[model samples]
Target: MKRVQDWLLRFRWQKLLLVWGVFLLIAAVLFAERSGVQYTHTRFRLSYLPQEQAISKAQALQEQPATCLLLCDTRQSGVDNARELFTQLLQDMKVAADVVDLAEVSVNDLPAPENYQTAVVLMPNVEPLGEELLRLMNWVEDGGGLLFGMSPSNDRYFTVVSAKLGVLSTSGEYKQAESIVPAEGFMLGGGQRYELSDPFDSSLAVALREDTEVYAATGDEKVPLIWGRRQGRGRIVVDNIGIYDKVMRGFYAASYSLLQDAVAYPVINSAVFYLDDFPSPVPGGDGTYIRRDYGLSISDFYSQVWWPDLTQLAERYGIHYTGVMIENYEDDTLSAPERQTDTEQFRYFGGLLLRQGGEIGYHGYNHQPLCLPDTDYGDAYAYNQWPNADAITAAMDELIAFQKAVLPYAVGSVYVPPSNILSAAGREILGTRVPGIRTIASTYFEDGSGLPYVQEFDVAPDGIVEQPRIVSGGMVGDSYMRLAAVSELNMHYVSTHFMHPDDLLDEDRGAAEGWEVYKGGLVDYLNWLEKAAPHLRKQTGTECSGAVERFAALTVTTTGTNDAWELTLGNFHDEAWLLFRANDGVPGTVTGGQLTLLTGNLYLLKAEQPTVQILRQEG
Candidate 1:
């Protein structure tokens, strides 16, 4: 790196020339492709859908028997998990309903009575005015359910809303640690703090009404965190604990799940397990433990020390892991002898993984940014802020070539960008240059100057799907538990988590300590998932990506209202659920899979095939 840096310093113009040269090459490729009438950039999101009609966003949000109305000042806030996820959770659970907010809605332009199944008044900055309250009351009286929530403040409208629900609110922070037990039917988990909320407690309290049923209770007293009652023509549920937890800082406590129950949204519980940075890069030294240690190669550790233990767990738990394979870094190619050893040992090890039901994914050719190297991993984002597309394509080409020769057979479509950062230009280059890679394994929140945040996931704007690995575990059991909780928000939602194999070996002490952490921490996590969420669907990165891609390419819509609808799916899995917000209170059924409750306003149809139907039961 020093030699290369010095060379670049001495010949600075070469960098400019290199960029220009790559640009020219890209132009030439584009021109040739244009002549043949096969332009790549135009193929962007178009290629993902070989045959399909788009479901208009307007149609999906049209009037329905069920509805979720979140009242908040949109201009005053950013992304709140409660506000954003509440709707997404509904979508995943498939309860057919429309979610309306002030930004795209006006109280004057509210949906018809047939659409008002549930009215959720979220934590607004201020108590709703008299006129708004009157409207909400009338909606409830007209049969609209209400998930009434307000942020922490003893001096706020607690008195007014509590009076309306016939409950009582008090001012006391939730400092005590305790388990919450929800009533038998609530799908929102009755679990521990979602890791993000510990150390600090919530500041909200509520005393239940005598006529109300408690859904979730907190502390030794089992005080109501959420409680509901039937009033006039509708039901109203309130969880002061939830409003405090979410409004304060998105702490995602069980209070949040309890709130979902309060809203009565049907939920699909799920979990996903996978590995990251599997084929670790050999950091710059030949005599290192990774290259050859104590007369054994790193591959020997993976196969003998690593594989045996993980394989036993996989077999025991029926889990399939996707190993993110890293090829090179900053021109850090292996010596001829080392490459030969790697080729042979990897073939054997990868074959073993494949036979044991594991798969491999591309992490990157070089574990550093594609733009350039600075002897520092942190500097990658700066260099790749706007990396050259053609150079990235060249690197991707080399990676595919190497994978063909070295890794085992399942050359899947998942790619985990190095440092978890890939410029949008770099991402699109992967889609255009390597059409075989249908998905990119990346952080839930992509950070790049090139890709817009909206197009980062849910099948990125580039036509490639992004199967997000929600959380990271570095050999910690409790951490894994927290991450697992974070991943299992809804059953129909994709669950994904990753761990580094190097976590198996202590950095300073090497394999001895890491393997212990891996066994004790991660294995416990798998078991916990089995016990906590037994129905978790296990799949390789390839499979997960394919599921997401198919779903993204699909267009599910409705019109003829016999409580039935038709959908045109893409390359979906053997069993998958397509969720939608429903109008009626009663649950429905389906043929391909099953009709399950997601939320009060949502329903999920699980099935297999490019076409499926959902028939709402007649009252």
Candidate 2:
């Protein structure tokens, strides 16, 4: 019995030691987590804007249906704070928002399609479901908006989401002082003091004070916290502060205000949905050529009746012309002799055009829409035939070969669809399949694609001048004159073409008594433009093409919503100064080299070679 007792005592002692080791291991893990965590101190209150007033103002706005999706892991304390804050925000803005717990719903069980127009996702400590979150980002890209908040513990997920949304989040921890006092220049509510003890820093705290500011600070090093970006038709507000701290919870007033503002801003601003690329000179001077349809089919009057007179008039007015060659088929049947004769005439005309400092771009193989399936061409002779991919390829090959044969004098060879009627497949063939063809005329799709907002501009039937297509041509007149002369203007670096010289010549004659009057008017307009808008620079189709290619190659550094932006124009040249307006204000100069801008409205910038660096400004 004594031996049994001794063995039992030894087992108890061993069990006690094991428990102590387990306790130490847990303690170590907790200590590591605490040490690595970031903390934010909320000691500063906005000097010019009080939290209550901001919230009150936001609440007074007409309410809209919006949801704040809180995706928190119930097991983490960080998520608990997020839940509490979300609950309070909903309670405060009951009319404007609803807080939805994503954890409660299955992936397939998202709210009905139209129940909400916006969402704020709180991903505090949970491991981000990468692919799933990526899919959700698609909603914002499609016009639905989102707001994201995360902690340093989830840096991997934060980075993935940031990249997809065109933003970047830092890796280290940041801290706000234990308390803060407003500075003299503070724009928000008058001098006020506050206390803070949150684990994560509120890097975006300054943004909450006004509609027009962005504030950020890096980790403990205090590398001026910079963390805010506009993302795909929506705004994303990021704070490095820990989600679980009481100090952060105390700022619920400001946080809720921000949430309310994000939801309401889009509705109140009509211009948010209307964005466009500022018109600037095409990067290179090569985009100035013209596109024309019809080679030899036009009656000999083209040269004998129109060329001599038009050439003389253009020379007198210091204007040049570039003729685009098109195969005009009055009837499908043409004897070999007639075909050869017509081809020769085209070559002769092309030579004349080049000698006169003009260019000749392709106007489709036979002045037809190049679509797949010959059956789709129907009975219209103008439709020609693009039976299949092979047929289209063959046609383009023949046309290019013919043009090359006429070489040396062809001078700047490019192709322009007869009536802007090429299919996607045709575009692919021109852009990729065809080799040695340096450039393709800008198409409608190129101009309108991916614009943040809907806008109306002039569009010509042929891919020529980018003009506003007002219904009444007589209202603006046939010259395509602009209505208002603002300091800034958007000029598309595109080649413009007009039909047979006879049409333009006739219009000129009808508008004036003779060629001299026409010449005088043209010269006067050019002179006035140069004097009034000396920055206007001419670009050729090739230059425009190169610029576009370069633009395509650039990597987008950031993205976000909010119409206001601050862009950096680095190392620009004297000749490349661009004109722009801030926040829809009057036009201002955008000198090249290093420049900064802040504005809400869209403006035009003119430059020969310009690089754009964008930052979102809250106001």
Candidate 3:
């Protein structure tokens, strides 16, 4: 028995050592496989659309008999602003609404109400119209659509038409609406409050009738922001919210949609997602969040935990991320930067991104903004400016060279500025020096500090397309979601969202909430966005630029009768997308296009030809 025990003890250590070595080998194999140890060189290219030499601007209000008339009084401040707002809105919607300047005509020259199916009155007062206003009211009762395009004046003139506008009573004074609360199912991302920035007295304090449907209102008191009511056989929509800015454009567009039986317009129909500062350098963020939640360092947390979550999200939603590479986080502005030699991390992350049907974009060689020394970053961001144009160009060239050396892919066509900051000199460099870059993605709206670069979705004079990021961060706030929803309606359904790898490290971006909570907020936002716009085609940065190109080049001329509407598209490319709304009729047939039902009364149409015909049955 003593000999047996002695033999067992000696072999036990050997067996245990053998078991530990086998486990280590298995773990190493898994780590290699999961981390993409074997990098695959991928050739990436921008999917630019066929360009047209010259695209004509769509002429607003053709000589053909108009279907809608807009009464604009250039004398009144509200009317002037409303005209500017509605003119662009109608032009985008392809609605043949003729503008009739009240200053150019007398009360006797007012057109008969029977001449148009719908009318928008932008005048603060109707005293100049005299008895002619009664003719329009009678026309509304006899099956015409009317929209009070601006907040009505508090006078006897508006009081007389108040009944037709669904106003049961009014305090006759303007009220300050603190927040915009859209009703459930009223807009894309409804059932939420979008707080106003320093709200003013822009809406009237009016009580609506019981039967009047309120689409939007003030958050606290529920004062009608936008409401609609039926008078006899006609419908009337009142846009009580008087604020007019770029942000309010979509809200007003939606309110105008309620004035018609049907409305159809072209949309970009693309959604792009961007990852800033990805696959470049490991961000130095506070490790408390990672340590507390995952017991891992920030660097290890990104590889093992954060990246896995993002990749899983992409897989679940079939999202293709455009990762903008930042070669290093060093602020090396004066010197000509050398090509980065440590290519393992870049290869690993870039390879993983490409394998998932993603694309790489140019951010910067370093974390510095591309502004000249004269430019100031202000208090919001502390970024060093470039010494001169030569320095900026040298850094950019080094960035391009490093990207080329690491990956077999062509230089990316999209360039996103660091911290969304770029100066006139920097832009000139990109336009002239960086010939491969075709698009610049920056912030859409200003953050008021004048630090972030602000842009509109349009082709710049230098021929570079501007595809601005509309929303950002994992903790998508109410205001950001509101902007997303509004842009979807006005910008023809294009959404640009950007995020960063180091968002987990910053407390301002909800890092202290831990990965689960931080990631949950992003997931919830994605879920809401998916539910709101399932039809939005997921595109990468270059693909989105391609979509913007097509949308910009095409001009739509709408002509229709009572039962049919024909759209003739100019500069028609290989394909075109449009949003057609059937408000008063059922779509009977669509020719020269394929129709996909998106939601109630909305159909996404893919036009194959320049001329698309739509036939509808009377509702």
Candidate 4:
């Protein structure tokens, strides 16, 4: 027994030593990896996409060569380094772009011949005079694009710029050379090796820290990373930190391309100037045609109007009708059972509609605008106005709860504001606060932008939604209702609405001739849509909003080292069926619907109808 005990003790010591030795080995390996001890230079792998792809994409929309003036107030080595980097990037773009160092350019020659499209002012530690800066602001607002880079220490300068540009500045110092991912249709190059680290100390990683208040006119309170506000006819892009440092250090691998894209986005978006009625032969797929379904909103049982003729007509026309049930309405108040009756009626009517392939969306808690005060005739203006965030939030909570109660399983991700009076702040609060609530409609009606007429506005930058507008009243005469049908067709989803048949009948009885024209226009539009449905890619409103959000989260950039280039792809599409065409014009197969790289020159092909191929030669 004594001898066995001795051996066991000996074994335990040996095991401890072995375990410690293994731990040490792992730590050593980790340290070596972190230190890049065993790292070696690798050959760069270029994509197979032909250079022609670039030319093709640029051919039709060729941008004129623009000169950029870089104004530097600092004589530091960092500024010199940044200038060199800018020079190199300009060469890489292969365009006739020039960057003039302001220090070298005589100040007496302040205004270059109006040909210089952009002026980048770099203020390291000094703040320019407010009046001089105002003049520069005026220049940019008039037409010239301006880029401003500031350091954390230059708070006064930052404040001046932010005040003028309607942006916020972070107080904390930024790390040099941070890698930023692009959002959409942008690509990044250079393998991990070429990835940017803090330029000050190549060993340190680049990072942008935010701990500052965003400055906007007192009433406009939205936080934006990069805010573009129309200053006169042109625009200004404001960066809180020293962009020159990032660009020079390779932190911004695709800064050059991104700058170009930024300048072009507004232009392209503006080119779509006119709003026309929805297009025919809708851009994408097909579906069956059923009679228009009117959503009869019933706040309570007593308010329910059961017209046998209407039900019969629905059946005859094979209409898959939907209905919204709110808790209460302006005139009719119901008892508990009556309210329950509303839900029960909805279930029965909903099931009937479902049998005919219809759907249902939530209305509101009391058949009124969620946050607006209640009035006698469902008029928001007459009700107590919603003036703050608390009221809006409470109203939203009530609406959501009511929705969950009435149709627990039947409800999908859709909400129709009672009068489209929802505020931008209210919508943002709801979207950010609620889960599973996908889409919300708003009241803005002007088609100032030629986009779809959907009432919702994306409070968050990059958010988008389908705007549903009332098109017609009846199916009899020449009231041609038009929408941006082609744009909506390309979208993954759509949302539209109609009231009850009684509402239509009332309108018709009051003004038969006008109603007839409205109805005829409605019928014509529906028929046209049905014929064109085959090309439309239909998705629910929730799906569409989610898609836009996901696309917004993506990062796109380009980076290149001496030997090779690498492009880092971001979540541009929730599920994009990407098409890659080789230099030879042959479509190559994509893996899991994603194309990582083209061994030779390759052009990216556009997809239509989720499956159809639309090819364009590379720029």
Candidate 5:
């Protein structure tokens, strides 16, 4: 006390002012809290920030209605990384949202419940309490749709939301299962048993309360896995499907279907097809179908068998298949047959396809990535072949030169890596090499396995893009899986499907089988494609690259709804129309990237950066 008095007395005015400032800060905080001001902080960006045109058309579309709020309370426990991933998944799901961290908003400044039709709470560790709880209750009661995920802390929310919304109540216990089969439904699972990551917390069998609407259920016919009910003016959907294991097992499409179908979200134009293992047939296979030697050289097979079938399919379906070009299938000693016919027959075939609205994409040199002949990330794994950077670069250059040789000016910037495997180093070779490649053709989901590379599509620090192919011509009978894959792909505004004419031949799925044997699977899938997602526009690999390049250059902002959506794309690509997944409804007119829906989510000729608007007819 004496020291304080002495100090205050010596620097009396300055010390007094400092003390007053501190006192005022504390007092103001206390007063604001007591006075019921809604305290708000912006939710940190959670999704991968896509590179878009600096001048976005979204500026005009800003005030457009929102479909959902990606809810993440920054103050919550265990929300740092998981929340960001969840946000990314939502963005990947193509759901437009305002990432709202309610903790940051003052109650007075909160937007009306009507502003957003749906409120999504995914894997939030902290249950909304106190004033936040009250605000949530008000929003739901006043007609806001609620979509929530399962977590330990979900009980508090479930109890409150269930009671108010008149939905089912649960103790928040996960029904244990090692493998559970889903009935034929669009939401989750298949008739075949699904492998669970956590056997103990596989799925939840929620007991439905009165007035609950059940759309899907488990095999037992007793427990409800998915159910929903109307609450006041809002709707509540309960998705008790657990994704922990599915995500681990790489069944990304199933997980998406469950979450999205639970709400019956509008799905349009979201698929791309790339037919791999074509033109270049690799030798020495698994003995099921990969023969010891040639039935015919790739050029003859493509010219005689695949081309006509593909061209017919394209004519019938209004689609162009992307046939990957492999310059060399074997060693120079073994490639004599390939060389003899390649220049004459192969280029002619390639040129014919290009003229027929087909696309040509690079596979690899001698069916190998830029790597030493023996460096093995795995058999057919091109991404991790080389032990060092120099080896990888050398191999990359060889491949680039090979493409230049094969197609000359016709070579596409899209590189469908051998076996859909790529390492960060291999990607670097694409970005850093002179006359480097632009887009990558592989699944968006990649696992780097704790290496220097990131398991993803987009190469970091450089602008190498990845256009992921979501569907392949496998499991020709699994219509629902195809549906899930296409819808999910559409969510990202990119559709990719790959098939090999070989697969149509052998007992194997992706083998280079003859056209006569392969046509059945193709026919079934194409018919299903027409029936299921006919609205999605199909583009050749070249067009897909053009669209990606165009989209990358454009500023994109989206206004979305359950039935319709509008993407205002700025800085459009010249002669580059972006194909969008939209419904077979009113495709609003536009200048750039004009909209068209084939049936469910297919279309063609989306001019680059088209400000397309989709209008859903109110049923």
Candidate 6:
């Protein structure tokens, strides 16, 4: 009996040993796949097809009835701003405009006022136009739309047309407007007041008639910022918000739509959410917050706690992330680029992101900013500049190779500058050597001088697309929301936001509020965005760059009749998106495009061909 019991015990011990062996083998296999040191390279390539203009200049400017006249005075101080506003905002709307400089054309021999549906005056002091200004005003009284691009000047000429402008009286003093409060439905995501950080005397101190409809006003005292009134058979829309910049383009764009019966403009129609320094080395941050809440280390908290929550949030909101990889947290600028071998974290996170319809782009070989040695980072950033261009090239080359080895199927087209500080030399190197880098995502708004490289949504002269992020961070504020709303109306823009994984570690970035509170703030903004603009397309960073490329390459000309509107696109791509506003007609049917109703009378049109025609019943 003792011998039989010993045999059974020995058999049970062997069985347990076999089980442990199997577990060890499985762990080894997983470690091999997740670690870069044991990588098995594959031949999957991701490419970026840069868009180019497909139509000639003559074909672009097709014969169309001029719907608007953009009048500017070269002698005026704000003329350049007016022209830029017209070019960047109004021209892209497909509204055919006859731009005439007052300095070039004699006031006596001005173009006929009967040829236009609306006239935009850019001159601050219209006294120089003599009696010619009256011709434009008479046209307005006779069923023509008129828009004053700037606030009314206290000159005698403007006082003569005070009644036409809906002004009952003027204090002849500029009123400081610290906040902009748009009425509900005046613009997308309206009703929230935006307080200006740098308030100035921007709005004119004027009272309006009872019939005048105020669209926006100053907070607190409720002074009118923008208002419109009916004059005779036509209408007059006054843009009293005197601010002019890329940030203010949307306000003016929305105000311009008030003049036309129906208007349409091309749009990118994509919203991209970028993750900077994601899937990199565990950031250096205090784990006190993590321990207090989840009882986990900073590394464990990121993987076990933070990631699950963030991933759930993205899934809930249908947000696909575009994570820019930072190979290492080392600030190495002088040494040769080194490959990261312990890439288990990157493999785990990056795989999940890609599987969930996300993308992986380049952040940097290290945390150092991509500036030359001489570049001054100022006090805004503490990043070290690269020693030389060769060092940058070597680092970037290694990063590209490493990403290709790890993520062979993912596209490396989008590149976000580390710390938003890329010097001119760094930019040149990127444009020339880094052919795979098709887009540079930078900041859209400047916080301070020498802080960040501000960019616009346009193709650079170097053929690389510049798609700047409008707002960032998890703690979304009213100013950021307001900016997002304005840009949407003006450019048919979708928001580009960026966030870091280590935000919870930094006290200034709401770490003390804890993950629950910080995440709640982010969720609130996402909910607001979903409710406000549900039709915005959620795309990865590269996809957004492609959309911007198409928008920048295309030129459109619009022609309108009593019952139909036709748009001819110049650089027709495979697909294009546009926003069409129908004020006096119900859009019936569309050819070469499909229409989706957005809000109020606004419709989103997706065009697949060069020509798009909308048939509508005349209202």
Give the total clashing residue pairs for model 3.
Answer: 0
Model 5 vs truth, CA RMSD: 26.7
Using Cα atoms with residue i matched to residue i, what is each candidate's TM-score against the true structure? 0.69, 0.37, 0.83, 0.38, 0.63, 0.87
Which candidate ranks first by TM-score, i.e. highest? Answer: 6
Report the poorest 10 consecutive residues by lDDT, candidate 4.
265-274
Order of models, best TM-score first? 6, 3, 1, 5, 4, 2
Question: Model 1: per-residue lDDT, tens digit, 123-162?
Answer: 5433433357666767777666676553334545556566
Candidate 2 on 260-307: residue-level lDDT in tens?
A: 222111000000000011000111111111112222223443445445
lDDT of 6: 0.78
Which lDDT value does model 5 have at 601? 32
Ranking under lDDT, best-scoring first?
6, 3, 1, 5, 2, 4
lDDT by residue (181-297, candidate 4, tens digit) is 222222212111112223331111112224322211111122222333445644554443344431132222222222221211100000000011100011111111111122332
| Model 6: pairs clashing at backbone N, Cα or C within 3 Å | none
Count the clashes in each prediction: 34, 51, 0, 56, 51, 0
lDDT of 3 by residue, 81-143 (tens): 788778766665556677888899876887877888889888777777778788888888898
Position 283, candidate 6: lDDT: 90
Give model 3's TM-score versus the native structure.
Answer: 0.83
Evaluate residue 103 in candidate 2 and report its C-alpha lDDT on the 0 to 100 scale.
Answer: 57
Per-candidate local distance difference test? 0.51, 0.37, 0.77, 0.36, 0.50, 0.78
Which residue ranges in model 5 land beyond 4 Å of their true spot?
1-85, 93-119, 124-131, 143-145, 151-157, 169-201, 207-235, 244-271, 281-303, 330-342, 371-398, 404-409, 446-461, 476-490, 501-519, 549-619
Model 3 worst lDDT window (10 residues): 52-61
Predicted structure 2: clash tally: 51
